[model samples]
Target: GIYLPVGLEKAAYNDGRTPIWNAEGCTTADIVYDDLRTTNGWDSSYKIDFSDPCAQKYIDSQARMFADWGYDFLKLDGVGPGSFKSGDNYDNVADVAAWQKAIATAGRPIHLELSWSLDYGHVEDWKKYSNGWRIDTDVECYCNTLVGWENSVDDRWDDAPAWTDHAGPGGWNDLDSLNVGNGEMDGLTNAERQSYATLWAIAKSPLYTGDDLTRLDSYGLSLLTNREVIAINQSSAPPAEPVTASDPQQVWAAKNPDGTYTVALFNLADAPASVTADWSTLGFQGKASVRDVWNREKLGTYRDRITQALPAHGSRLFTVTSHGTDLEWTGYEAEAGTLSGNASTAGCSACSDGRKVGNLYGGGKLTLDNVVVHKAGTYQVKVSYISGDARSALVSANDGGATSHKFASTGDWGTVNVVHVPVKLKAGANTITIDSGSDGYAPDIDRIDVQK
Candidate 1:
């Protein structure tokens, strides 16, 4: 769509705010001006105007020609319908019917898959027209060095749970492609890549290999081919969600036919964390043996819980006939926010689960919701953060009072730094806030941890 704005569509304006109309004068209020542009850009040379009948005939012929060419899967990228309206705009609905009808005429079972993040409200339309759709954004994820809570592959993990009902049988929520095998494109470590694969498998997203298959490393291959994990995915069992998505201490569990569960405990933080999954919360009142699904080794049986220490972005995917308790108070479980700027809940490199990113100066603040303390006492609150220079932040717990914490130079953006302050809190849910105190830099905070 970037070759030239005028070529995509004729309009009084080509900026994102203006509306675009087809030849039929079919204009939509729900669609932003940008939504009306060409999908893949294909250099703007061979673009189809869905509004034209001649274009419809061409699309039909193209579909039949694709069938003739023996291509089974056709991913029609960036085509949404007027039915999937944004705001008040009636965005042009591409001539998808032409493709469907043409493929039918060609007598081929060509599976249509939509590209980009289709509007969630149009799931039924997707199921009717395509075999799968991407539920997340793109896969150009920068791994841990990135800071936003919602980005690329990890965002898929966050979104999969909510769309479980949309996935089953022929229809699926595609988690894009596997970014694990690529060394340069993705920034995930080996363990993180393994976690990514495990998550995709558990969520039952179609396993499209985004990497060069011929050059797949042994470890990547192993992660992709682990039969037990694949069985859990292919079992067609329901997708798993976080029992408690406590950053650095989240628990994701799926039920099995044998009355067992595949529970994955993820440490989505920068530092190491000992996270536990409660048996009761997991719907098991008693105990069950926990076995590592990847290694095929028994981690022994436990009565009421299982807790494991995990590194940054590390995960433990295992099966249990019976198991234990997990962590509490994850990232962005914010009960409140006085924060300005784009707060990133996405895990950063070597930072705790997520950070509140904003110009946290001049009374700019980020409040972490539901900070729990065991007893009413003084505790040291540590904020894992990022900054290229030194700064200071004011903190308060449950409005008990405010304390100031100072941060030193962290050398680089990815070099995680920490600052701590002592504050008193009650035994229940308390709100802890960080405010910029110094005049220098407002550091990117990864997470706030209060220790008694």
Candidate 2:
């Protein structure tokens, strides 16, 4: 977990004891698996056959030697089931286990990091044996620069979420490398450089820069050295959950233990974008104080929500703390309700619990079977939704007469807005059905909130 260089080494450099080239007069031939042939393809190099006992011995010995040599980290690259596909059913699980066992028996503590998109199916194994596992291919663009967004840096946005729960305390998820300490050589615009660091921090991925430390520009230095932003990464907080699941615009948030929340808004689109973060999705009610973490500026307090216009691929991180009389609100995620016809649950970054019920059109409907109320009365219900175009849907309580509600355009589908509707609820349990009728299409339903 410490970043100071204690020395780092890979497992493929061994010669006589590990995988040997198909050479004559090699004494360690018994350790090599004769059944299959695996090569590095660049030269006459062959992969280490981890299934052999002697090969494992060599790996274990190398680990112990590294530990004794004051090495603090070991990164095993080209691991299988996700990394190298030699087409011979090559799996490096045994090799990883050997290294893990070796490091444990070693006299010194060493960090074990697996690399190049290790299989998530064996994530439990990675979590158990290594300190971190890379979730995507190399972030490097492999061109003249260290990295480029379109090639691989942007790939993490689609891949990291699935591996969120797999990262934590003793072990972490490695997002390749943090390559933003340098300016143009980092191969990203100033906006993108910060956003890159933001995602790696909030996701709690190991933050080791790929850029040269001696050449950090002021903007790149600021992005890397901001204490408030670094605190979010080191807070050991769970990975931020996306409030809006769409691309081009995303809102991610995480709750801290000190009655505060960390929220990040991203604009991945080509043009400017207004990204909004709702208090309901952040699991709080009432006004809250917001501070821009990167700018180290205390923004004024706001009630219910806040919006920021960000440039292309830009991002903002904020810490929000509630300061008003806290109102208790009950939220019923639309995905938890029953779906009929084409209605179904889908991932939405701008919704409560990262999900929403959509496709409510032409016989599609969502029925909440257990909507409870203490007393019979009319109450305000806040329905959260996303709509680029104006739409309407019918809401019926207890299969009673339906009332149609119109939703105005919120500018785009990436933004979420709440509309309050007065609905009468009987004492105890009540059923509410949101239907789009035979031919009408309704806006996507994130969730509905009611004051308790």
TM-scores for all predictions: 0.59, 0.71
Model 2 residue 403 distance off true place after TM-score fit, in angstroms: 21
TM-score of 2: 0.71
lDDT of each: 0.61, 0.75
Per-residue lDDT of 206-273 in model 2, one digit per residue for the tens? Answer: 88887888898989888888888888999967877565444457777888889788999998787889
Q: Where in model 2 is the C-alpha error above 4 Å?
A: 1-27, 39-52, 84-88, 324-452
- Taking all chains together, the TM-score of candidate 1 against the true structure is 0.59
| Number of clashing residue pairs, candidate 1 | 32
Give candidate 2's root-mean-square deviation (CA, Å): 8.8
Candidate 1 residue-wise lDDT, 152-238, digit = tens: 655655456546667778878787777676544355677678778888887888777767688777777788788887888788577
